[model samples]
Each structure stands twice: as C-alpha cells, then as structure tokens.
Target: MQKQDFYQSLVKQAQALISGERNVIANMANLSALLFTSLEDINWAGFYLVDSPDELVLGPFQGNPACIRIPVGKGVCGTAAHAKETQLVEDVHAFDGHIACDAASNSEIVIPVFKNGEVFAVLDIDSPSLARFDEADRDGLQALVRCFELTLS
Candidate 1:
C-alpha cells in the first residue's frame, strides 16, 4: 500500500485498538505493538513517558530492549519531548546527540504526545533504512498522536 494509504489505515487501526480503553499503559502498549507489526523496515516502535521534568522513562514497546531512561534534550525522543514538537531524523548519525538504543536504526521519528498542552509522552519509531520518514509520515503519525490524546481525560 502507498505510504499515505498505509497510515490512513494505521490511524483507523490505532483508534479501534484503543477504543474504550482508559488505561494509559494499556493504550501505549497496544499502540506500540500495532505500529511495530504494521510498519515496514522499522527496527523499533514504542513510547517514552515523561517521568519527571527532565527525564523520560521507557514505556511499552515492540522491539529489542531499549534505553530505560532518557534525559530531556538528549536524543531524538528527548529532543521531541523537550521541544514539545516532532523530531523526524532522516539520518540518525547526522543528528547530534542521537541516542543509539539500536545500532541498526538509521532513521527515526519521534512525536510528542500532549496532555492539556503539556508533553505527556512520545511515540517513537525507528527504521533501519536511511531517510525512512517523510512529511507524509509526520502528518500520519501526528494524526495517530491525536487519536492517543482522545483517550486521555
């Protein structure tokens, strides 16, 4: 399927998976699994939740083990959280301070999830191919983040 079409379906699937689920952990777990299994060439897909003002604790994921703790502004995940904006890196090596949770990951996209206008968590996806993400992915993943926000009270 085309990238756009795939993400459209992904958003629907994500919404359906989280429907009627109020538990945050459960939702993040399911969402991570959904993205990991559905997306192509991805080495990791998961979440890092804001555990403190300057740190993000690893949450649910569907991939190899990852860094358990990341300081704010440290890596792609932390940068997104600290900036409260999406960080789409076409080349992980080119990104200064890029965290190498998985050496195989060449590209990455991290979208910060907001709760009441504050960064709550981040949806992180990593691919093994260079320049794996584009504007389409950004828009699609951002939409998925919106779906996640709906689950919040």
Candidate 2:
C-alpha cells in the first residue's frame, strides 16, 4: 500500500480506538500503541504533554525510556510546542538543539496537539532511518492529531 493510503487507514484506526473515550491518558496510551505497532522503522511514538509554561512532561509512549521533561523551545518536541507547529526532521543529528533521548533515532516528527487554540501536548514519533518521514507522513500524522484533538473538549 502507498504511504498515503496506509496513513489514512492508520488515522481511521486511531479515531475508532479513541472514540467514546473521554479520558485523555487512556486515549493517548491507545494512540501511542497504535502508532508504534502500525508504523515501520519507528523507534518511538508517544506524547509529551504541556506541564508548565516552559516545559513538557512525558506522557504515553512505546519505546525505550525517554526524557521525563523537555523545556519548551529547547528540543524538537519543545520547538513544536513552542511554535505551535509540526517539526519534521529528515535528520535528527542536523537539527540544532536536538535532544538525544535515543542515540539510535535518526529522524523524527513532532506535531503539536492543540486544545482550544492552546498547545495541550505534542505527538512525537522517532525513526531509526534518516529521512524516514516525508510530506505524506506529515499530512497523515497531522490528520491523526486533528482526529485526536477533537476529543480534548
């Protein structure tokens, strides 16, 4: 299957998994597991929730242990949260201020999850291959984020 179609299916699955569940942690846990098992070559897939005005705390994920806290505007996840935008890095090593939670991660994508126009958390995925993510992955992940965001209220 094409990447686009795969992502579409993944997004649908994510929506269905979280449907009717109002608990944020439950939803995040399910989504994290969904992304980890569905996407190939990915080393980490999970969330970093906004914990304070200047930091994000690890939420739910599937992978090795991750940094517990990331300051906003510091790393890839922080940059996405601080800018309220998605950060898709073809090469994690090339990104300035990239945090090395896992040295095996060569590429990454971080999408900010918003709630009522505010940054609620970020959906973060890491890959072991360079240039692992492209525009298709970005579009698919963003769509998934939008689907998840709908449950925030």
* TM-scores, one per candidate: 0.97, 0.99
43-113, model 1: which lDDT tens digit per residue? Answer: 89999999999999999999999999999999999999999999999999999999999999999999999
lDDT of each: 0.95, 0.97
- Residue pairs with backbone overlap in model 2: none
Q: What is the RMSD, in Å, between candidate 2 and the native fold over all Cα? A: 0.5
Which 10 consecutive positions of candidate 1 have the poorest summed lDDT?
1-10
Give the best candidate by TM-score.
2
Q: Would you give me the overall lDDT of model 2?
A: 0.97
Model 1 residue 78 CA deviation (Å) reads 0.7
